[model samples]
Target: KYRNLLLPMHMAIRCHEYLRHTAAAQITYKITRSRSIQVELGKAESFRETLKATQGPCNTSKPSMLDFVNKAKWDAWKSLGSVSQEEARQQYVDLISSLVGTEAPAVAAQPTGSTKGFQTLLVSTEDNITTIRLNRPEKKNAITVEMYNELIEALDLAGKDDSVITVITGSGDYYCSGNDLNNFTKIPEGGVEKLAKESGELLRRYVKVYIDFPKPLIGVINGPAVGVSVTLLGLFDVVYATEKATFHTPFSQLGQSPEGCSSYLFPKIMGAAKASEMLLFNKKLTAAQACEVGLVTEVFPESSFQSEVWTRLKAYAKLPRNSLALSKQLIRVVEKEKLHAVNDAEVERLVERWLSDECMQAIMSFFQAKSKL
Candidate 1:
């Protein structure tokens, strides 16, 4: 459906030029932030392919081994193999659309045929605010593999949309119950090794979206948050919680290491000793305690949480959008590279943990205990 919206080759060329100029302009003011090296490389590769799709392949001899950038760009173009030029052009246009804030909605309002709408989230935009609410109340909004993909898509859209602020919360009483353990039980034909690698990659992309979010991201924690849900708050610009809310990351209990760049941000936010009590010892903190320790910005009484938080957020959303976004980019620029590195290291460690006997045993025991209950 979105393919019909592709910009022509000449327009795509102009778009690339525009991006370069905009990036240069923003850099001059120190408001432009660096994306992960991988994302930047991918964009470069896509631009190269777009050129090849319009113009013929590069005329020069193959890039030498020492020319890392040229070699990678050449390889990316070569990877298209027999794909049609039109297809390559379409792919390049899609990439540009995402970067230039022209992406279609993550889920159409009335998707037809095989297109699916969001099943795990309720997304709505109003008054320059996009609220992405986790909707699986029956399961305390636990994140399944499918939800992970939807979240990444939603965040990407919200980041590129005209919204001035993006808010994340949950329906019902729980913000999130953490990862759905069932994700581990359904090993595919390729087995645990393949599953580990794929899951790690997916998780990496999930966290990357949060790290790279352009607009102000606010977390409204109405209830308990666990595991990745708790860890991810570190990426939010501000977090408001109800008196009922609690933050917990029982990673060690599940034989998992920290993720969501929590390993780095947590220490910075709460100091090494307090961060260790939660990340290393699995200490759960009440809303007041979390705020005291710097994990949450504030805690409101449960009775007034919704009204109070929304009122403040609505006021924030009315400010000059560009100023807010550019200021945020500047603040985040310094830590962006470090966050990406921590994310990579954390995901790598988690992949190893997921494949380990200790993690498997711990999970099995957890299930066993649940069954007996």
Candidate 2:
């Protein structure tokens, strides 16, 4: 039995080396012992063999330059047996580049019978209210690159179409869940700055649309309004959330920072202490709590959420469009000028925090535990 002890000791070293390239891999090694040590070692060996086979000359297809860069980075990580601070920086740059380069593809515009023209957002105009449902429910109403572009278009149309007075809701029961995580893996290996710029541009554009739109923007939060989904609500004129709705920001949890100018808007809307609690502490709020904090205007039963929202929208619609638009503009103007600077500062601070060892460790730990579960 003592003779077999050397085998486990050897397995541990092999497992450690194998996991060296991944940020989350070390957490697995830490959480599990002996048997896992052997298993991880075997998996590492398998991975090495698979990688070798894939790179062999007989495989006619060439690996893309970005793919090769990632592979080289991973190999270097394995050879070093640990990621240094410098290596972590390079990895962040690579990861961000990839995220921005391969932003989610656009959806084809659909022809709608409504006079608003073709749009990705499904619009239903009843009386003075326009309900624009985010049509991609299969993906849980997750926002894609194309959806962002289309959202701007929809807002423009809503502004121009006099028949539509109040813009009620866009997404379905789920609302919008921010960028898809699956796409996060495919971001290119360079151009991190450009990527950040583009992402910021899209978000800024959306904020402008929300703030400058001529009528009230009411959000109907039916489920989890996560990441950007949660932040976007800050731009809404009023929000009606179901009792089932929950809001959370997983920026620190996801190895990223708060985006969509929430940092500026949240503090303005909810005050410094409350905003800090939500953004810094990553607090998740229930619909009732959100209402109390002024993030949500009211909470309604999930069973009748749609009907209730429509009732509210119709009430808003009854107001003179010009008067409603003017009131909205005045409120926005009072809060204006400060939001842009605050948003920029917040993102800069968040980016720094995201790059810190503490945040990195937290993110890696969360992912590792999540993977195991």
Candidate 3:
């Protein structure tokens, strides 16, 4: 479904570019599969309008009636009558700029300094704090393979930077919905076994960064978090959440086991039975519940969550950086080796799970159910 919508829009953009009579206007559209359905439709309409205005009209001689894809594109293009090319160009630029939002540059090729062309995350530093934000809000900040790599790199940079505090959060409503299921479908040329191995390796390194992070690692969970996103809180120094936030690890539902050192840390933090309820039985915990279980440091009222968390963080950042770093390192030193072992074990187990029939069936069922919706 996503592919069907994307291919036509991509081709339409290319066609528009090809038909351009002037070099004054050029569009560099960054296509993302994570776009919401409404957003996708809105962009499609805009694209059609832009194409019609700039190109004058769909080539009636081309896109034969039997060519459904091209025909649909033709119909869409025909529906929007042509306008002045200059007007269309301005409208297209304005629309793209608006969609890009203030967080990113309007032109896709524009560089985001220090972030080094990160596609899935927003990394920024301020007031002695380095923030790594999961930016895919339309998909509840789901972590894709690209996101995982970007996160690892971001954390590594943050660890070495002058920032006294490193924070992780999400853009928009969700803190994170956890791994994008679509990540599994993108198997490399070596097949599932190879993909599993490489993914497991990546997961290991991702978790290890958190375990060995030098600065104070904070999680600002503004909304619901799931799977590895929730599990990773075990390695964070502090996890501040909004009152409306929730933490969930639905590993069993996906026919997968625990990761991010959760298998070892969850029981240690919340007690075996409570952890079992979450890790084994897929029980979701509210912000209060999570705090009580030691997964969250504290919960703030949604009305003031941001102001309150940042106020404290800024104050904390004012303290002697080395002292704070040393203190955190001292606290984590004992568990560093333990977390490493747990991470390796979990990754190996996950690799096996990824290649299993049960996991595949569960993922297929999930997609089937979603398609029906």
Could you give candidate 3's per-residue lDDT for residues 183-229 as a string of tens digits? Answer: 88998999999989998999998999999899999999999999999
TM-score of 2: 0.61
TM-score, one value per model: 0.70, 0.61, 0.69
State the number of backbone clashes in model 1: 0
Candidate 1 on 77-100: residue-level lDDT in tens?
565566655565555545544444
lDDT of 2 at 255: 61
Where in model 3 is the C-alpha error above 4 Å? 1-116
Per-model CA lDDT versus the true structure: 0.82, 0.63, 0.83
- Per-residue lDDT tens digits of candidate 2, residues 1-373? 3123222333234433444586534333332332333433343333333233222112233445789764653563344333444453344334323333444455554334354543456876667676677766677777777777888888778777664464545455676666665432334455534444565566667766765677778787778788887887887888888898888887756667776678777887789998887787789988898898899999999889879777767777787878878888888887666766666665566546544677657756766787998
Runs of candidate 2 exceeding 4 Å displacement: 1-120, 168-172, 188-190, 346-373
